[model samples]
Target: MIMYTAGDVRVEERPDPKIIEPTDAIIRLTATCICGSDLWPYRGVEPADHTAMGHEYVGVVEAVGDDVRNVKVGDFVVGSFVISDNTCEICRSGYQSGCVHREFVAGTIGTQAEKARIPHADGTLVPTPGQPDEDLIPSLLAASDVLGTGWYGAVAAEAGPGRTVAVVGDGAVGLMAVLAAKQLGAERIIAMSRHPDRQELARFYGATDIVEERGDAGVARVKELTDGLGAHSVVEAVGTQESTMQAINSTRPGGRLGFVGVNYDVTIPGIDLFFAGIHVEGGPAPVRRFLPELIQLIWDRKIDPGRVFDLALPLDEAAQGYKVMDERRATKVLLTL
Candidate 1:
């Protein structure tokens, strides 16, 4: 949004993003989305004014600069929320999310519009097998953000066979986290959701347990399901003080806590963590690192993350999509160009 407000997003015509560097490439957005994280910016929690909005996108490349090589014109691609060049040291280390020259492209590259200019095109965008079928677009788009974030949470939390995982929050990210944990082979997944709709989807996505409580009560319920030892891994998808604490407390001693929530004022109690001996890790999930494999899964129709999107709108109705998500009337909203 060019202009920002506390409860609303305003869309206006502005300069279209173009290749500004040799590493840049421009793609015509075929599908883009309003991410849960976008709520933070829309609520005036992030620097809003004069910033472009959106990051997740599925599109066909329109042009590439001199240095761009990994992608080509007419190639259908899915871009990561964060931009990076793939050849960097960090990218090779499986941490493209933390690339040395990583740039937050949401409000700048702005996938929300009809066209987006991607910096470090080689690293930031992954080409799909072919022009995705109509039904595959949404699932592929989800991989660019929510699905990727959730998958990263599962990976970070060490969700796998014989392990019990607890996820805090029931938003799109949280619900997707449940799916990710299940796909990662977690024996049991405890999804913390008070919303009946979300809880239902959690089960569809492979949640073995559903806890309707929050805060300490939720943690207690999680422990109850895990033989009073707490979950082997905890995924924190909500970037709030309460959710963060729940994730931390729900993990057993020496367990891992994978948090993808964008922390604001949420503080981790040093003393409590010191005593718990929990291994806490995660920030902005390096979704790009996992895009190739995730894309393959979607292309094969092996997993359907499109289920998380409860609302869909055309690009012109972008404002309404934001309203649906901000008011919690919808879990995730998909915007079509």
Candidate 2:
């Protein structure tokens, strides 16, 4: 898929991608999805002049460069949106997304097509235990981005036993954070969402409570649920001034806040953060660091993150996929080849 301009996307027959670097690999995509972040371009929040679209993908390796060793042709693989050499000091430090050699795999080359070229193949792509069944494809694709991001949010918030974790968004990432908090053994999980469908999914993902309110009222409800101390940890998955304040204010002093939302016009007040006394941390998730464990959980049927894809369409209808997601008509849209 290609975006000629804002609010415009098209499926075109482009020249097949080739291995440009010694560490490159070519993949035949089986599935890809429209991300909440993609909306930034779709809604004209960012400029897109003949740019390729999409980042989340799951596919079969068609070819690999001579330097590639970890995976070979015919291997089913998943990769993070950020390409890393995995040998840099940053990658060794468990922050592959910040590797000394890193590239965002969207604008230069996109995955929302029949084929895509991946640089740093050995370090970026993780081959699955085997070719997953059709039913597992969406879940595997989720692991490529959203699931890993959500897991990172929970971990960054320090969710664990005896802690009360609160999630401040109902998108795919927030719902998955609820799952992560549950898996991490949080004593209680509170999901803030007014949408009934998402609230039900949050409960299924182990949320112990739901706050239908927003702004100050929502923060008050969170405090009430946590005995006025606020939550021990808060995951901010919606990037807006309102959501950011809601997450920070809903946390107890000294509590940790993990913000994974892609900020648009949101800004953090220095004074409020200093006075709140909350530890804040978040950025582009180092998904490569969590891919192995997350892939295993999906393979073992321990989690079903694919439920986030409420709409699935063929790759040809890429425009419609973007449309539904932009309108909030679908939690997520999956494009099948």
Candidate 3:
């Protein structure tokens, strides 16, 4: 077993975790991610100290409890970054990510560790067709966090055919929002980007336009493109006051705004929002709501979300992974156990 302690995470052999209840399962992690939200806790923005740090992972079920009916030992599984048993009232309502008995797997289950003890296994884990090819693991892991968040953002934005969508921010989730809009049949996608590399990737992911400028200049460009009506939908992928304002201002009256950035120093202006007449919606993206469909999309190779991960590091180099993302040297970092 590995430990995520204060200061830094380390690997050491310990007693293997066992099924503490019939609903529990043991997952031998194959791949995991260093999430952008994890940064809040790691950077002391959240009161996290010596907490198990990680929320996204893909793995094989090493063992299963007797009562666990959906998954079995030896099956390949991809679980949401947040764990929830699918049978709860909320799960049945398609909000398993917020199930009444939901138990997040990040800190307690600790996906960053080599192995994880998952509770509410049936509701939390979704099985794939078979052991995925090595190249597919990263994409599967994306299903656990960024991909789901992006998909949720798009859905919330009301992305669809004939809709013009503007995506604020260029993080992995933002880039995936571009992909999600395209997949959902949006007629045009404007990716607000300043970095050439991210801009190129945005285009490759199906962004029909690129706004190199930001703030008011970016909003002006969006208006110019939309005949002064602004886009019909706006995706806010960076949780900041500036990006939030940019998203709100970029949408036309009656348009929808989907925001998924983990809010940091973000305060919505009541007057601006009310007068914009844009329908704003979003939160801690209910990823589990979209996991089944996204998992199938990956399985069929209809889309590849793994491309957002630009760097891979051993789990031991987790701190470096954080530094790389903080320094903007990598679009995203994948941690291998």
Best by TM-score: 2
lDDT of candidate 2?
0.94
In order, what is each prediction's RMSD in angstroms? Answer: 1.2, 0.8, 1.9
> Compared with the true structure, what per-residue lDDT tens digits does model 3 show for residues 1-337?
1334333545455567889999899999998878777767666666664577778888999999888999999999988877787777887887776788877776676788788888888888899988898989999999898999998899999999999999999999999999999999999999999999999999998999999888889899999999999999999999987888889999999999999998978888799999999898887667878888998999999999999999999987877887787777998899897
TM-score winner between 1 and 3, please give it. 1
Worst ten in a row by lDDT for model 3: 1-10
Each model's lDDT? 0.89, 0.94, 0.86
Q: Is candidate 2 or candidate 3 better by TM-score?
A: 2
Q: Rank the candidates by TM-score, best first.
A: 2, 1, 3
lDDT, candidate 2, residue 251?
91
TM-score of 3: 0.95
| Model 2 C-alpha lDDT per residue in residues 102-153, reported as the tens digit of each score | 9998787799989999999998999999989889999999999999999999
Q: TM-scores across all candidates?
A: 0.97, 0.99, 0.95
Off by over 4 Å in 2: none
